[model samples]
Target: MNTDMTRNDFRTVAREALLAAVQGLVLAIVVLPCGLAFVVLTLVSLAFVPLGIGLLTTPAVLTGVRALADTRRKLAAQWCGIHVPAVYQPLPRGGSPWTRTFVLLRDPQVRRDLLWLPVDMTAGFVTALLPALVVFYPLQGIMLAAGLWRAYVPATGESTWYLFVPVSGQGTAFLAAVLGVAILAVGWRRTPRLLAAHFRLTRAVLGGDAELAERVRVLTETRRDAVDTSAAELRRIERDLHDGAQARLV
Candidate 1:
């Protein structure tokens, strides 16, 4: 029974790690490129705002930026249970495009979103990619040990590398495999924490102390609600036992 429970625990950990890896890859590949592209578009549009051509276009582009930031906030909450409330200053209704564009430019949340884009594509990109790489890179060395090194060697008859171990022959291949397995064993348990770090990194940029307080406030409210719900449930169950069972006995 103990052995089965241990295996189940490890299985759950492994599954969470794999999901984190995939999430990291998604942030690295799709989110990174889309964010950078949006930034470029926004900058280009801003450059033309003086010409009256970008008055409308800039706000449209900014809408995309807002959407992207909101998506990040949603992911942060869903993936890592971090609550980053959207605190944007609402746009005044019926303003001219010129007025609205500048108003968005002046808003603190909008400014942070713009600032975060560059950071996200760079530091955020690497942080998001590292968990997946750490989990998968060891597999290459293991594959090399399984006779993939011969395929790795070129026609020039040169040796290939696997984690600093040169795979010149079977002996080196075995060494590489040992190193790979060691790494995998060590890092597998930490994969979920690594992805959690990625979300926290973005949260640092997207929301700071205010967001932390908000998250805490939300958690307290949720806990209170849960306690209240449990109390109500207990009372209902007691009433059922009293009215149904005691009435029959009486």
Candidate 2:
């Protein structure tokens, strides 16, 4: 029974580790292209400023970025179990494209999103790649153990290996496999926390304090509206009493 439970535990950990690795790979593939596109769009918009086409391009870029940020927030909620609440100020109605763009630009949340982009690109890339590396290292060790290195390096005096660790023969391969298993063991435990940390950072930069402020602002406005509404209702009741009920009594 103990052995069975141990096997099940190992299987569960392995499954989770692989899932995290796949999630990281997906994140990397999506984030890299999106980041590149956003950078390119921003540059194009700037370059087109003198040509006056920037007005069109700039707003489009901002809209795209906002959409992308929203998507990331949702992804964080789904994958990391934490919702980075939206803190974007509502855009004013009945404005020209340029006016609306300026409003978006002025928003603190918008600025935060912009600030998060480069960092996301860098840190996300690393986080996304690391899992796959850990997962695949064992396979590389297996290949080296099987002596397939001879086919690849027919005349090599030396060969460069990943992680700068040698996996030359059965002994080294065994070591490499052990190292890889250790990494896998540690990574499964850490991957969820790592993803959570990234989402927390996203929330911090994109909405943390700003979200609180927005909530406060909303509550204040609601309170004011409620007070005004009560005052108006009291006056209407007094007027009704004076014009109808009191007048009828008189």
RMSD of model 1 against the true structure: 15.4
Please give each candidate's TM-score.
Answer: 0.81, 0.79
Return the lDDT, model 2, position 173: 55
Report the alpha-carbon TM-score of model 2 versus the true structure. 0.79
- Evaluated against the true structure, the overall lDDT of model 2 is 0.73
Cα lDDT tens digits for candidate 2, 15-44:
777776677778878888897788778778
Q: How far is candidate 2 from the true structure (C-alpha RMSD, Å)?
A: 4.6
Report the error of model 2 at residue 184, Å.
2.7
Q: Encode model 1's per-residue lDDT on 133-237: one tens digit a residue.
A: 878888888888899888988878788988688888878988998988898889888877887887787778877555555576689889999999999999999
